[model samples]
Target: MRILVSNDDGIFAEGILALIRAVADLGEIVVVAPDQQGSASSHGISLHRRLVPKPVDLQIQNVEAWSFSGTPVDCVKFGVTQFGEQHPFDLMLSGINEGRNLATDVLYSGTIAAAGEAALQGIPALAVSLDGPPFPFDEAAQVVRKMVDRLQFKTLDADTFLSVNIPAESVDGPWVVTRIGAEGYRDRFIRHTDDDGQAYYRYVGDVVRNIEDDDSDITVVNKGCISITPLRYRFTNEPAMDTLKTWF
Candidate 1:
């Protein structure tokens, strides 16, 4: 299998390197990732600016890598359209990210966005993240490698992808399939004055609240089990559309 790898943590990050090491024996690997971290960039593409992709020497045996001066989504776009056109990737794997993208946090994650971009192109994809202050990247990568090996047997919808979160410490049990959690971090901003007396707001809030659902991603991860949440790009509210039809 030919696999395309990308990440929001940039190409030189230890997480990505660990990911490459874990899956190197599986198949041919090509990496296209951001030169700098694009953490909460979501699925943003560089529409107005010119994207520059430069060849990077990772010195990893049997892996060709490139660093793009754009977001994680841009890396996926370029990797699929350019390199994939030549080699034809069987799967696209993003991250082994430095931190967990749990619950609604995936909505703001560039790591998950990269995988989403690949799924949009009809390629199978998965985003891997580790919940951490001290990230256990090797363990996370091992989990991801096993998942990748078994992905061929699983069936997913055209625009669907998987978002995986692993505990930084040893897991208590086996991995669990979970639903996306409705819970998220409460938005809070701190008002501050600059040295020049200019008032500004700084985003500061680490408090996360998870929904009561036991099958939710947040709940599952907190229980020390690896969470695998299947996600799709469709945002249409079908039930709402039927209710709104009466107004017309």
Candidate 2:
């Protein structure tokens, strides 16, 4: 199986490197990732600027890597399309992101966007993330390795992708299948005054650690279990179709 790896974090991030090392034995691997941090870039592609994939030396044996000056989605797009017929990708692993992407946070996450782009191209993908700082990327990579192995043996549905979140400490329980939480970060704003007495509000958010629903991704990770949420591309609200019809 040929695997395409990418991340929102720059090409040389430790998390991505850890992930690459863990899954090295899987198959032919090629990495195309952002040249700089594009954390909340979502699914944006470079439309105006000329895009290029610069060959990068990750110093990892037998793995070809490149750095792209675009969004994470761009990396996945370049990896899937530009590799020619012989290097068709079977799977994409889009993170080991330094931060968690839970609930609405996925809407803003380039990490999730990379995985989403791969899924859009009919390739099975996984977006892996660590909860907080002091990230144990090696441990998370090992866990992701097992998940990837399972995905390799048992095929994933074409339209689906998995978003995984690991805790800062050791994971205690088994993989808990969960859904995206209803709520996102508990946000706040702090106002600061500049030299000219201009006030600027700084955005601050602490992710809601737990939720009432045990099956929600937010709560699952809080309970010391690795949360695995299967996701698919969807925006149409079929349930609201009837309401719209009545209005018309």
Candidate 3:
């Protein structure tokens, strides 16, 4: 299968490199990723500035790689739009993200955003994330490769994609299909003064899991299981529309 791989962690990140290595045996891989960090950039595309994708040597023989001066979503856009005619892709993979993107994190994760972009464009996609530090990037990637091999991409809809979150440790339980649950962090901003006496603030946050959420991504990962959540592009609340119809 021809695959288009992209990530928010830039081209040289260990996680992306490991992902490339893990999936190399699958098929022809074309990687177009951001030149720098793009973690929580979400689905915002660069509209004003010219997005130029520069060819970069990833040192991985036979695998074409490019570095784009844009967000993760932008990288996917550039790749699929510019190269789709010549090298039509069968699948799109994003992440092996350095950090976990679970629950509400999907709203702000550039990793998921990239995969979501592909899903919107009639392509099957998967976004894999690693939870916490001491991340076994290479190992997590291999798990994704195995999972991908088993998944029937043909069954997936044009507006659907999968959001996968792997535990920092080994998975002892079964990989569970869960819903996006409550995940919130306490935000803190420490004020600092620069040499010019200008006030600056450094942001700090800590993850708080909803232990009560049994059928959720956060709780699933905490229980030593891989969380696989099928995400779709339809945001129009069907139930809410019914309620609105009564009001009108």
Candidate 4:
């Protein structure tokens, strides 16, 4: 299988290298990733600026890599539109990310956004992340390898992709299919004055978990299980349509 790999954590991050090592035996691997960190960039694309993708002299066995001066979504877009024409990819994998992207965190994750972009282009995609302060990328990569192997034979919808979150403690737990959870960081900003008396604000927040919901991705990961949540690009709220139609 031909595979394309990309990440939001930049091209030199250990997470992306671990991902490459984990799936090296799968097929031909081509990587297009951001040149710098893009953690909370979401699905943002660099529309008004010149996107420069430069070839990187990476020594990973049997892999070609490039670094892009754009968002993670731009990497996938370039991969699909340019490199894909020469060698169509069977799958697109994004990140063994430094931190877990679960619940509402997916809304701000460039890692998940890369996979989502691939799904939009009709390619099978998966975004893998791990919970970490001390990122155990090697262990997470092993789990990702097994998951990728299993996914090789499975058929997924063209419009959907998988967002996987692995617990940092262990990879021995069962894999669970889950829904997006309500857990998110409560918004908080600290106002500060600069030396010149200029006011500035810094964003900060605590992760709030919805413990009552067991079927959510956050809960499953917290319980030491791998959480695989299938996601689609559609944002339409179908249930609210009828309520608005009554007014019309």
Q: Compare the candidates by TM-score and give the number of the best one.
A: 4
Every model's Cα RMSD, please?
1.6, 2.2, 1.7, 1.3
TM-score of 2: 0.91
Off by over 4 Å in 3: 171-173, 206-211
The best candidate in terms of lDDT: 4
Per-model TM values vs. the true structure: 0.94, 0.91, 0.94, 0.96
Models ranked on lDDT: 4, 1, 2, 3
Models sorted by TM-score, best on top: 4, 1, 3, 2
Error of 4 at 160 (Å): 0.7
* Tens-digit lDDT track of model 1 for 1-248: 88999999999999999999998887788999999989999999998998998998777777889999999999999999898887788899999899999878889999999999999998999999999867978878988988888887787888999999998875435799999887767778999999999999988757676445899888888888899999999999999999899988
Query: Which lDDT values do the candidates have, in the order given?
Result: 0.89, 0.88, 0.88, 0.91
Better of 2 and 4 by lDDT: 4
- Candidate 3 RMSD computed on C-alpha atoms after optimal superposition onto the true structure: 1.7
Q: How many residue pairs clash in each candidate?
A: 0, 0, 0, 0
- Tens-digit lDDT track of model 2 for 28-53: 88999999999999989999998877
Tens-place lDDT digits, model 3, residues 89-184? 888899889988988899999999999998988778999999868789888888888887887445687799999999887633479999998878
Output the better candidate (1/3) by lDDT.
1
